[model samples]
Target: MTTMFRKALNALPRLGVQVVDLGPGAAVISRRGRYSATKVSADAWMVGGGRRSTRAPAEGWGLRKAAASSLCARHVADFLANYEVNCVFDVGANRGQYGRQLRESGYRGRIVSFEPVPDALARLRKAAERDPDWWVRPVALGRSESVQSMHLGWKTMNSLLEPSAYGQQRYKRFADTRTTQVQVRRLDKVMDEALHGIANPRPFLKMDTQGFDMEVFAGAGERLDEYVGMQSEVAALQLYEGSPHMTEALAAYEEAGFGITGLYPVTREETTGRVVEFDCVLARVSSVPGSAAGVRP
Candidate 1:
């Protein structure tokens, strides 16, 4: 009887039902799906052939509470099927969420990830442990190789190599924060070593290192040829706080034998009150003569 009840419950659309199995005298039931903060009293509810005590949905007991939970996973799956990409370099890998997402979406290729934060790097490593194609590195990529003090944000979400005074101040609004000294390496050196002795290296690089995207390319130098395409986070609003402007950054790509092929807006105007908080510029390396012969602008 209990097995039948469990099967029936599982068959129901897993929208907002948190089912807990407690032996005999105790069973706890809570809402699943969407995140919320509310308390409800436990009571007995009838199921299959038994009556067990469970907490009603914090709001109420009905399917109406589950309407907001959309099938986002399906959409993401569709996207992965349609997009054609091979090698992926995830800069600012954080906890390797993007890497995991790629794998889950059936992306079977080399995935190189970089994370400067020690704690975050640890988590990223654990997350990618099962994936052999996922490579995680702990060095921060910049224009030069040097030890730099990075500002640690409250929840690892706001950590940045170049945090603005305003950003720091805003971060202080919350407690529980710490800073650490991290090693910074030049992308030029890293890429040269990674692509060394290889006949043809065509990798897709995605960079999101707060305000240090331009410096990363600066370090890539001539080896930027190994990367056929790239997506970099360009901070227009934070440009005044040390980030290079979009125009200047794109010019650097042009000098490096790359052309701006696409742009994706990260933060919209309705949320940030700015034209575009973060811009993802897609660049492709030129294959023409004298393309790789000039210095970055």
Candidate 2:
């Protein structure tokens, strides 16, 4: 399409036509033409090669209050309720989405959020400012403590690792990235600092580090057992370079004596209906604080 025509299409929102940008080199879609527009866009993408918008409706942090009522969030609420968790360590807590969702889910515990990217950390801090129990730490968690280069992609996609070819091709936002130096710390080294004032802490670790879950878990080291429950993002395919697959991370957690409590898909391939990644929740096997009705074996 010509630039002039594209501009005109983009201006359609003023005329009651909701235009959604599908990303670079893809066609824009109007609300009414969504069905046909998607089909044509998919075909064009396959032939000319363009990334899909991996952003999902559920990913809208602003609508997290609505999301908290979802089955996945309810599962989390039930987990916290049954286990009596008192604190949460939210790793890769971009803009405090998880922590806020926890609150909306009726979790009245302490939350310590860790984030490295300047843009996200600022927003995360602002989000947590009014909540006295929510704290923000401006450092990324990794296997070792050091200064590392973080690849800043579209806010939610920022990561310590570069996006893989598949990742870049799968999501338009992942293709655009700029690097920035960030402070990385091992969780073991900062555990005391994170839990400083909390007495009798029963912590739950929630990790969504854009394919760096295992690295963050490794950073917890032998102190991992201090957390009663844990959640990690696992992928069926490599989104970040050198990232482990789902099996590797799951096996490692299983070996560490945690059993699966919930596995929720984060995203999926539209055409193939194949899950791309998941939020896997696990709890210490023999140490579950209460009855195990919904908890998976």
In order, the Cα lDDT scores of the candidates are 0.59, 0.79
Across residues 70-154, which tens digit of lDDT does each residue of candidate 2 receive?
5466688788887788889999999888888899889998898999888888899999999999989999999998999999867
Candidate 1 yields a Cα-based lDDT of 0.59
Off by over 4 Å in 2: 1-69, 290-297
Residue 233 in candidate 2, Cα distance off native in Å? 0.7
Clashes of each: 1, 0
How close to the true structure is residue 108 of candidate 2, measured as C-alpha lDDT?
93
For residue 17, model 1's alpha carbon misses the true position, in angstroms, by 17
Per-residue accuracy of model 1 over 124-185 as CA lDDT, tens digit each: 99998988767888988878889887667645443444555655544453344567888888
Least accurate stretch of 10 residues (summed lDDT) in model 2?
Answer: 40-49
Which residue pairs does candidate 1 place in steric collision?
Answer: 188-219
